[model samples]
Structures are given as C-alpha cells and as structure tokens.
Target: MSGGSKLWGGRFQKPTHELVDQLNASLPFDRRLARHDILGSLAHVTMLARQGIVPLEDARAIAQGLRVILQEIQEERFVFRLADEDIHLSVERRLRELIGPAAGRLHTARSRNDQVALDFRLWMREAILEVGEGIVETSQALLDLANEHRDVVLPGYTHLQRAQPLLLAHHLHAYVAMLARDLARLQELYRRVNRSPLGSGALAGVPYPIDRAFVAELLAMDGILENSIDAVSARDFALEFLADLAIVMAHLSRLAEELVLWSSSEFGFIEFDDAFATGSSIMPQKKNPDVAELLRGKSGRVFGHLMGLLTVVKGLPLAYNKDLQEDKEGVFDALDTVALLLRVLPPMLRTLRIDRGRMHTAAEQGFTLATDVADALVRAGVPFRDAHEAVGRLVAYCIAEGKTFGELAADELVRFHPRLAEIVFPRTVWDAVRAREHPGGTGPEHVARALEASRSELERTARWLQQERQRIDEAFARLLSEEFP
Candidate 1:
C-alpha cells in the first residue's frame, strides 16, 4: 500500500514513493510486539463499549477477531507485510479486513502515538520481569558455587596486584550484591512503566467521552496519564528502562571479563568446562573462554542502543513527532541483547569449573597475609604505622630472596623489625584466614552469616516475582472474559 492509499490517506493527493515505504517498514522487528498491540487494542475497545462510545456488538466482534489473529501469529500462520508500517498498523489493517467496517472503530479515541506507547510499555513490563528472572538464576548459580567453595581461599586484587586474601565464597558473593541492586532497579522501572497513556490521542486529549481509568484497569495499568500532552510526548519510561538495562549489562560484562582473565594459563585460577569454552584452531593446548568473551563484547552494543535512543529523544518537542518512530529499533535492540545475555550467562556459570587448589596456591604466593601480620603486631602494642612499615620492609626482603612471607622464620621477621615477637608468625594459610574475625570480613563465621542473609533475600525476591507474574496473567484473563463471555 502506498502512503496515500493507506488508512489515514484522505488528505494526500499523491502516493508515497516505494523507497519511503521500505524505509518506514517496521514489520520485521516490531512484529515481535504483535501480541502486546492486540491485547492493548482489546482493552481499549472494551472501555469504549462500556462508555457507550462504540457498540457492544462491535467490541465483541473486534475482540473475537483479535483473538484469532493472536492465535494465528503464535501458530506461525500470520504473515506481516511491509506495506503496514508497524505492528500497530499491521494488526489494525488485518482486523479491519477480518471483521469489516466495525474494525475501524477500534482506533476511535486512539492514535498511533498512544497505541505504540502502550504496546512498548506492556512489552517492557514483561521484559523486565524476564530479565529479573535471569538475574535470580545467575545469583543462585553464584550462591551454589559459594556454598561449594566456602573454605577455599583466593587472592583479592587491587590494580591487578594481589592485595589481600579472601574466601572464594566472599569474592563470588560480591557479584550477588551487584545483581541485587540491578534487580531493584528493574522492579522500579516496572512500577514507572505500569501507567497507561491510551487516552492521550496524538498530543492532546480525545474529544470523545472515553473512560481512561476503565481502560487502564482493563490493561492492568496502575494509573492513567494525567496530562495528554505529557503522555504522548514522554519517552522517559523507555529511556529509564534502557538505562537500567545498560547498567545491568555493564555489571555482567565486568564479571565476564574477570572470568576470561581467571581462565587464562598465566592466572590458572579457573578452568571452564568444555561446554563453555572453545578450542583454538592452531593451538593444541588452548581452551578459550568464548562465552565470556562474547558477553563482554556484546555489552558495547547494548550501550550503543541506550545512547542512540537518548540522542533521538533529547531534542524532540512536547508532542508525538515522526522522530518518535525511531524509538523502536534501538529499544528493540537493547531488549534483545539483554535477554540473550541473561539466558546464556546462567548456564555458562553453572557449567564453569573452579580450580580450588590453584586459587589457594595463588592466595599464598603474594604477601596476602601481610595485613594479618600487621594486625598481629598491632595487638602486640606496636603502632599500626610502624607495623605497616615493618611489613613493607619484610616483603621487600622476601622479594629479593625469592621467598614467600610464610617461608620467612621468626628471626628473619625480627631482623626487619626488632619490635616483632615470636607470636607474629602464622603457621599456615588457614591460621592467616581465620585471624580475620571481624564482622563482614572473610572469616569463617562472617561468611556463614552473609550466606544466610543472601539466601533470605533471594527467597523474598522470588516471592515478589511470582506475584507480579500472576498479576499480569490475571489481568489478561479478565480482558478475555469480559469481551468473549
């Protein structure tokens, strides 16, 4: 269909060029939102009928036609055509074809502006929940690893140099903390996205006596947009959702980068399972962390999507512009990118291998116990500054002699600092680890408490997620019953 031959083509005298039609076609990507667009249309039609704006019989027929379309789309029988600009127009054009003139009434008191806005919000609500589930799954994987490796020690780094000793469990749980914040941000985005904008036709309120709250209820939105201009003009929800996704992907990339580093032969700190790694084409003894590398690389694309949308919406005026049509491609790209990452990361983590012996050995090679030695001296009435300088001298001496801190004798320590006594020397790695008994430290008791707390938080988040899913399902069920009953 040429632009002038399209449904809203009354004012145009000439047909739009074929090049413009191809350029404007969103059916290839936005077609993924077909179900959401149909659902939003059903809710709007029901509200129109209840308010006597459209005949109840027309509403019933439209609802029935949309249900059939949804089923066809799901069954892979529906063919989206490029002549239709987007899912909104494509579904509307099909509904008109299926049910005759009454299908035209479905667009009453609505514009492509508010219609697409509603579709995006509905899609994002579901997308955020799915991403949250991915985060929960990843958290559980880390929790399992932490439980299995609670007693294993690893070197914690600063500027890529080993600076301290910590339990492997403690190190893994740090990711859990980062992900918990990510989950909270996603939930917040859902709350903001749950508001309805259907009554905002184009950039102004529709003249018809439509009940926006009733439509909001039908769509299971928490509230209605109070101002019509603000409703159609605002892409804040999209911006916020994309920004949240970018942040989460960044955290994931950081973790993936570390996994890549740890799996290297130079570090020998980890050994990923064959399922998550790949063999080099030319090297006989190479297992690359290909999954982690991909995840890290994909993060740049997600960030680009976020920035692209921000730039598109930054200078637009207080109304729906054709520029708003540019919103879908970037938002769709970001959603797809994040969803794919979430789906793959959990399984990769679950299958990856941990080299506990290597981690323990690396933990001991550096002067990771220097803090413990300094603390021991502090307890022996030596000032902390003095103890720090004393440990620094001893570390330099050990480096020159090519010996580990643990290999130095008590007399050797005394040679660096005369104030040092026999009790300052730790006999084993476990002795050094157990010495850190402060709360939130990597001591055994502290790690156990943290594990319990993390388990409790996960349980709470799971309950909230289940309830939100049920709420959305029930709202759709009600919409179906009201129209088809």
Candidate 2:
C-alpha cells in the first residue's frame, strides 16, 4: 500500500511518486522521536489553551489525544507508515483521527519546523544526561581500579617506548582526567541544548501570542530561544555534541588501544578476563582483544559522523532545511556507540588481571630511571639540558653494553659525570617510581590522593545526576497529571 500522505497533500493533485516516497521518508529513522514529539506537542497545546488561542476544551482534547497516541506508540500498537514522513506528521495525523476536528487545533501556534527543533532539543537534553551518567559509570570504574592498583608500578610510555616508572593508579587516572574534561564539555552542551525553540513557527515568530516561555518551563527548558530563525535553523548544538563525542571517542580509543596493546603477548602487562576475550577459529591458542579493538575502530566511525554532520550543515541558508533531516541518524548512532562502549569498558576493565610481575619487569628494563638520574644530576648543580645529555650518554652506554640501569652501580654511574656520585640516584625502578612524591606525581602517595579525589568527584557527580534527573522527572509528572488526570 502507498499509505498516501495527507498532511501536505492538499496542493498536490496526484500522490507522491513511489521512488520519491521511499527516498524522502524519514519515519524509518525518526520514529525514535515519537515520544519527544508528543511531549513537545503537549506543552505546545497546553500553552495554546492557556493563551486562549485554542479553546480549553480543544486543548484538553488535543492533550488527551496525544497521550493516547503516546500510549499506542509505547505499546507498539500504533502503525507507523511511510506517508507520516516524520514523528511530527505521524503524531498529528493520529491525534486528528482520535479527537475529530479539535485535534487539528494541536498545531495552533507552531510549525513542524519549530516543533522538531523543540523535540530534538528535548532529546539532546536527555541524551546528554544519559551520556553523562555513562561517563560517570566509566570514571567510577577507573577510580576504583586505580585505587585497587595504587601500589602497583607500571611503565609509562611516550612514542610507545617506556619513558618512566609510574604507579598503575596514575596510568588509570589519566583517563579519569580526560573523562572529567569531556564531562565539562557535556555540561556546556546540556545548557545549550536545553533552550526552547517552540513558537518559532517554521521560520518566523508565531502570532496569536504563543507562550514560548511557559512552554519552555513545561518542557523543562532553560529559556526561549531568542531568534526564531536561528532557533529552527542552527544545528551547532549537534555539531558541538558530535565534536565532544568525537573527543570522547578519541579518549576511549586511546584507552582501548592501550588495552589491546597491554593484553598482547608482546606487552603482557594485563590479561583480559576470558569472558571478555574472543578466541580465534584457526589458532587454538589465540585469545583476541576484540572488544578493545572494536572500541578503538568505532572511534573512527564516530569521528566520521561528526565530520558528516559538519559537512551536511555547511553553506546552507536555513531556517530549517531538508538537510537538517540528516541530523538524527548520526546522533542516534553516536549516542548508541558511546553508551554501549561505556557499558562494556567498565566491566572489561574491572575483570582485567594485571600482571604485576610483567609490569614491574618491563618497568625495570626500559632504563625508566633516566629522568630520575637526570633529576639527581640537576640537584648536583648541573643544568637540566646538561643533565639530560649526561643521562642520554649513560643510557646509550647501558644499551651498548646490553646492561640495564639496575646493573649500573653508583661507582660505575660516576663515569658519566663525577657530580652524579655526590647526588641521589634511583637504584631500582621501584625507587625511581617512588622518588617523585610531589602532589600529582605518579608516586604512590600522590596516586592515593588522586584516587580519593576521583572517588569524591564521582560521588558529587552521582548526586548531581540524581537531582537533575529528579527535576526532569517531576516536570514530566506535573505535565502528565495536568493533562491526563
């Protein structure tokens, strides 16, 4: 069946072409916004009734009709068809069918243009919250794991070469810092995405005195969007969101890349818990870090989405163009990608079995104490450049002799520079790792403090999320009671 569209059909004498219908239909992807559409419509209709633009009885009917549609959609009993085109039209069509002519008043002071902007904004608000929670979840895991491994020393790397001995906790908390910054980005996005675009009425401001502010309040938005054209046109919010997500995915990819590297036999720093690892069909002994690899690969996909959206919205004169329809699919995919990645990573990390021996063994072999030796030279009144060069020679000599730092005694170390013998030197990787005990250093004490701070931050974030979600929920409850009660 063609499921002929009537919403925009009045001027067209004939039905839309079959190919055009299939090609242009957004219902397949945008039906996910049905709930958000109804929510926006209810707030809009309620405001219309309050403004006396739509009669109170009609407003009630529209609200009731929308709620009924919401229930049907929720129950999957409502039939979605190609003709409905998008959630706005699908919802309006159903509302009209249920309440006769009064439901036609539902679009009283709005256009699908501003309505969808409102819906997208509402969806983005919830998404930011959900993604924030995922970030917290992942950060909490990192914190707990860091706390658990505070005493374990691992080799820190630069250019994929071991550079220094660091506490495992410090290695883990680096990701916590990245996530903290990403959360800040999300906070700003949440603020930006919470502004209401309702009453913008296609491209221009609505007539008949639509209560944009009241609608904003009912929808829990921060305020009305100041420019009606910009309100419906700009998708910088989505760009910012995807940009933030790209960075987020980059962080995750970096971490997942580490997990993949760490679990490899060449590194042997950690072993994945078998449940999270995949086995190769051909190689009986092969245990693959597929989860981490996939997470890393998925980063590119998210980055592409960000760039794709950026490409889509460029050079467009829009107070709502068809190109804007390209927005939701990328967002939906990126949201699912980040959320699912977060869901798997925390547990994958928790189940990981760290090879303390392998880590320490590797930490010792990399001449990881070069910085410590340099610092000792600096303490002996050598300038840092000279000290760095002196340590560089010592490291080269050790490598040439097939000797590690531990094999070099203090008396032999003095061969590099006579000032080195009078100054402190780290005799072992453990000593080198512990020597930098300053605040924020990778020293055990510093890591313990950082882990505590991370735990505290996670707790505060949890409380904030709970409170914010409660306010949003209460807004929904109040809106529901007024219309449905």
Off by over 4 Å in 2: 1-6, 409-411, 482-485
The TM-score leader among the candidates is: 2
Tens digits of per-residue lDDT for model 2 on 1-485? Answer: 11344446666678777787777788999899888888888888788878889888888888888889989998999999787777778888888899998877887777778888888888888888888899999999998788877778878999999998888989999999999999989988888898998888888787777778998898788898899999989999999999999999999999999999999989998999998999999999999999999999999999999999999999788567887889889999999999999899889989989999999888887788889889988887899999999889999999899997767777878888888767868888789877778987887887788888877887888787788788888888777765532
Task: Show pairs that collide, candidate 2.
Answer: none
Q: What is the alpha-carbon lDDT of model 2 when measured against the actual structure? A: 0.86
Candidate 1 lDDT tens digits, 364-418 = 8778888888888888888999989988988899899999876777688789777
Off by over 4 Å in 1: 1-6, 407-411, 422-427, 482-485
Residues forming the 10-long window of minimal summed lDDT in candidate 2:
1-10
Q: Report each candidate's C-alpha RMSD, comma-separated, in the order given.
A: 2.2, 2.4
Clashing pairs in 1: none
Q: Against the unseen true structure, what C-alpha lDDT does each candidate score? A: 0.84, 0.86
lDDT of 1: 0.84
